[model samples]
Target: MVRAGARFMATGPAQSFLRRYGWRIDRALIKATKGHLSMSMVMPEVLLTHTGAKSGQQRSTPLTYFTDGGRVIVVASNYGGVRHPAWYHNVKANPRVTLTSRGYRGTFLGEEVLGDERDRLFELATQFMPNYAGYQKTTQGRRIPVVAFTEVR
Candidate 1:
């Protein structure tokens, strides 16, 4: 467990930077690192991609995901912000999604988990990335949503 003071100290800059440019910054970091940072240091199976939701336009982002029983789990922590992240809404609107990682590309179906199932997945996610606990803490009064994606044939 991260000390409360340390958690606060670390989150200040991280939250600020992520809020300002987390999408682009994390995408670039993932591309440059070739999924090394996300997979090894963070979680596994993250990619940067652009897709259209309601507007049928293009939206690109770098997100950390992991596979559990063949389902891909994604955290909408947004560092525990009050509202859901942009990609969360995008995927919610359009379940069809595309991803690219380490030279591998594919399409998948995206779905959000709720209630007890969501809680269970969130617990599993925290095991891989403890910072998620801090993110959950930072976003008080709000429930972080966890999204699951399954490959569409």
Candidate 2:
């Protein structure tokens, strides 16, 4: 079921649909479930709250994520869109973020992974979600950005 959903979401129409409205739907569901659930239930999800790069207002985005030791890894694939997702810009502007995942909510520091470390994390992420490779292929050569969020204590 999860694989089917991933395949469906990788389609052009589904990608467009998700880019248009997936975040809003996922945000509500994640919040309502107190972070225990989301549209990508089996795929580990998180609600990332960040200060908007332009508006400065707080914005929340639900994203598929993977755990890397003590950090949470998320990709700004935007479903293979040519442009990076807005949240990526927000995180770049404000490294401080809040995340709600798997019934846990906390403040975190977001860092953009790069170079060999980025490559390693991306490979790990791809192993967890093979659809990411297809997403990368559709990206028209734009290397997707990966962000790691470490809980801020």
Give the winner by lDDT. 2
Instruction: Give lDDT tens digits, candidate 2, residues 65-139.
Output: 988989999999988788899999999999999999879999999999999999999998887777888889988
Which tens-of-lDDT digit does each residue in 1-153 have in candidate 1?
A: 223423442467855765677656667776776555442242354773546666788776777677788877899987677788888988888878887665566788888999999999999888766668877887876788999888888
lDDT values for all models: 0.72, 0.89
TM-scores across all candidates?
0.78, 0.93
TM-score of 2: 0.93
RMSD of 2: 1.4
Error of 2 at 80 (Å): 0.4
- Look at candidate 1 and tell me the lDDT of residue 138: 72
Best by TM-score: 2
Residue clash pairs of candidate 2: none
Candidate 2 yields a Cα-based lDDT of: 0.89
In model 1, which regions exceed 4 Å deviation? 1-10, 29-42, 48-50
